[model samples]
Target: MRVVLTTWGSRGDVEPLAGLAVALRGLGAETVVCAPGDDDFVELLARAGVAHMPLGPTVRSVVAGPKPPGAAAAFKLAPELVAARFETLARAAEDGCDAILATGLMPAGARDVADKLGVRYVLACFHLLGLPSQFSAPGRRPGTPSPEGETDNRKLWQQDAERVNALYGPALNEHRAAIGLPPVDNVRDYVFTGSPWLAADPVLLPSEGMTDLDVVQTGAWILPDDRPLPDGLEAFLDAGAPPVYVGFGSMAAYAPKDIAGVAIEAARKHGRRVVLASGWAGLSAIDDGGDCFVVGEVNQQALFRRVAAVVHHGGAGTTTTSARAGVAQVVVPQIADQPSWAARTAELGIGVAHEGSTPTVDSLSAALATALDPQMRARAEAVATTIRPDGAAVAARMLLDGASAAA
Candidate 1:
């Protein structure tokens, strides 16, 4: 069997699919990963030994250089951008593919491609955003209370649905019409097709009233192993007590230096050592010395284990990494589903979610203090105990089972 797995966005998006591809290959399925044509991403696929199919714009171009303030402004071009991405998936799926598994960021036309090719399609979500729940909104900010009434929750869900349709409906319908499919009225419903695979642990996000959707909680699909830490980072970790990790992943591209400085200052105020992840945000430019190490991208799993606490943008991948490593977290969410993950981290009692989009020194210091508390550390360790280590294997088996059943 040949499986084509597609995803978009930063390392968070690409890493999970790469892990799944490796697992599927082990299960006797020839796997291909279709993602942006970025050199780093292509190199990642090459290193993972998974077949690669380049598609869409490079993530750096999309995320690195930008002139947007809020998440809403950043996504102004979503319709056209998503349409172009779907066209790429459509073209890629035209090949002899047996199944199409896509991440949450994949365009709605991914399902259309599977239908057009007569193959099994599975939608995999790293977070709980895609699954509709009356208990709470999908991507609400951390610490925001769930609506008391189910009616209010449904209304919030409907508004999100409308917002998605408004952003991608025209282009989506155009592609559908071009491909001889009926127009979709609800983009959310269209995107959440087939047996929905949730790439998170059920213990972390229990499915209580999500019976309307065929949701499968497959745990967290972590990368196979850690890349070697830089010599400087190793030396820093060896020099003193575990340092706090501070990085915003792809969220703080515009002001990485400023963000890094703020984080370093906050940690210094609390007399804590810090490791700053440059990631796509370009934090490597900051040249802070003495107890503060500004380094380029390294494996989250490895670094989180060496760190006493993690202060980050609350990406789903980073959240899971911190949890599984038994480190406390301080989430400073900026955009998209980050706020939701931040909320979840706080709700799990493993972290503190700093309020506001940008973190002030005071707020960050306070959150960092909370994350380093003994009780929070214990809770984080307890949460780590419940996470399945073989999420990739379980996801591969689930996909195979779904394909067999469809056949």
Candidate 2:
């Protein structure tokens, strides 16, 4: 069997697809990943021994660039993203693969590509937001209309579909016309299809908001990381009681500008050292203190094991990693889906969900105080024992079995 897995957005978005590709390979199938052409993603795919096909421009430029009017950039990029994926997925599967599995809001091209190739097309999501639900209001994609103060789920979804149509319909039809496919009327349903795969830990993040769809809840697809911590980082870990960890991952720019120094001070207040990740936010030491160490692209799977508590922007990958490591967490949510992760952590009794992204020393210190509690740490460890690590293998088997039956 052969497969093409495609995804866009931050590292969190692409990593799951990479994991699935690796799983497929382990099962004796050919797999390739079509992802953003960033150097980070390229290196990641290389490490996984998967072929890569670049889609669209570097994501760093978009996130790092100055904010456009609210959703302006997201709106502008939607059509372009579909068109690029339309061409790239086709080229990636030119040799004729069995399926195209994609993650992210923009997968019209992948769907159409699979349709044209007469292969399976699967839409997978990392979170529970986009799928329609009467149980909860849907999250608005960037540049989509927000039903401010809206309570009705049906009305909110109607507006959501309209935005998907308005933002992507014309460009999608244009690409479809060129590909000799009929123009779709409801682009939203055309992409979401009937059964979308939810690649989240079912225990941690339940398959919620699925009134119209039969959502398949696969566990979180985590890229296997076995790299040892760098020598300096290991030395720091050994030198002190496991320090509080602080990093916002991709949301650094949007997070409070002073979060780094504040988080350091907050950890210090609890008489703990700190291991800071210089992620996209480019965090650094607040002072020349020996208690703080700043690192770059280190091994999270390894580092999380020794950390006393985690402070983060509540990214799905970081949140899941912390959960898997059995470490207490304090999630300071910055944007969409983050607040939900924060709530999950708090609800699980494993950590404190700091109300918002902007954390002051007092706020973070208070949150850390709760997260570092012995009881909370025990809960974290208990939860960690149940986080399934077979999501990729599960997804791979499903894809191959479905394709074989169809054939």
Candidate 3:
């Protein structure tokens, strides 16, 4: 079966789907991945041995860098509102395939292709795009959804629904008519994300309104095997025992120097070494006046395991990676989903938040102490082991099974 996976956004967004594509390839399914134009993602797909097609420029411009005040906000709502129009959609669909799976905001075009081909479509819900409870890690009992999960945050979801309608509804009908296929009952029906026949768990997912019968918790979908650690990382791990692992993933957009002094001071206070990642956002230079080494883009899963504790601006992927490594986390959220994941880490008792709104040497040192505590570290290790066996191959098989049914 031919399977096409479409996604847009930063490395965190595109990389998961790429992992899925690699898994699908293992099943002998023909797989193609589509994402906005970016050399990093392009190279990543190639390295993973997955076929890729570039859609457009990487849209990080909206989130970071100097731009129009609300440009990011507008694009966040309806990405199609700012991206290549229906022609791109048409072109993507032109490649015959059994099914099309796409992430949020970029689904309109893929949905058009799915309708044109009369094939099944699935939406990958990496985060709570419209779901409120899915917005934050709930404080409820395990496996229970939060009360506010359903309560619309001032009709934000309805706006998302409306935005979906405004962006995709017209093109959907036109595409259906062009192919002589009946229009779907409602645009939402084709939109399946959670469970029994047509659903699955959300990431940092709330448990409310879901039953054991509704969704399968396959744990977090991650790279099947841990990548090799860099040359200097092992030495860092051995330095003064496991020091706290501090690095924001791809979304960090601050001047590294501004953050460097604080991190070094904190590391000294805790009497631990520091391993900083200079990811796409350039965070390593924050090492001014410190002995910290800015390790540029190393294997996080492997590195996290070798660390005594972690401090980060919680992206979902980073959060899960740290959790799976069983090391306590000290979250200094930057923006978007960072705060929500930070709240979850604190709630789970595996970590603590920075004392102040912004992380500083004092607060970061305190959080590190809490994270490195024996009890917290043990708890984190247990959670990590529980979720570590997440089956990328199984998920790939599931996608292929869906495609085979479609065929």
**Number of colliding residue pairs in model 2:** 0
Model 2 misplacement above 4 A: 142-150, 208-211
Query: How does model 1 score by TM-score?
Result: 0.88
Task: Please identify which of the two predictions, 2 or 3, would achieve the higher lDDT against the true structure.
Answer: 2
**Candidate 1 structure quality by residue, lDDT tens digits, 1-407:** 77888887778889899988889988998888878878878887898898888766676776676553445643554664566556776666565677888884636678877887778988888876656777666554222234566457678777767767776777878888887888889987888874688887676666546635778788888767758988988999999999889887766454433778788878888888888877766675345478888777576778888898999888888888888899999988877778778888899899998898787788788889899988999999998998788889999988888787777
The models' CA-based lDDT, in order, is 0.78, 0.87, 0.63
Candidate 3, TM-score vs. the true structure?
A: 0.80
Question: Cα deviation of 209 in candidate 2 (Å)?
Answer: 6.4
Off by over 4 Å in 3: 67-95, 104-106, 132-156, 163-217, 254-257, 286-290, 355-357
Model 2's TM-score against the true structure: 0.97
Once superposed on the true structure, which residue ranges of model 1 sit more than 4 Å away at CA?
Answer: 69-76, 79-86, 137-151, 210-212, 253-257, 284-288
- Using lDDT, rank the candidates from best to worst: 2, 1, 3
* Candidate 2 residue pairs in backbone clash: none
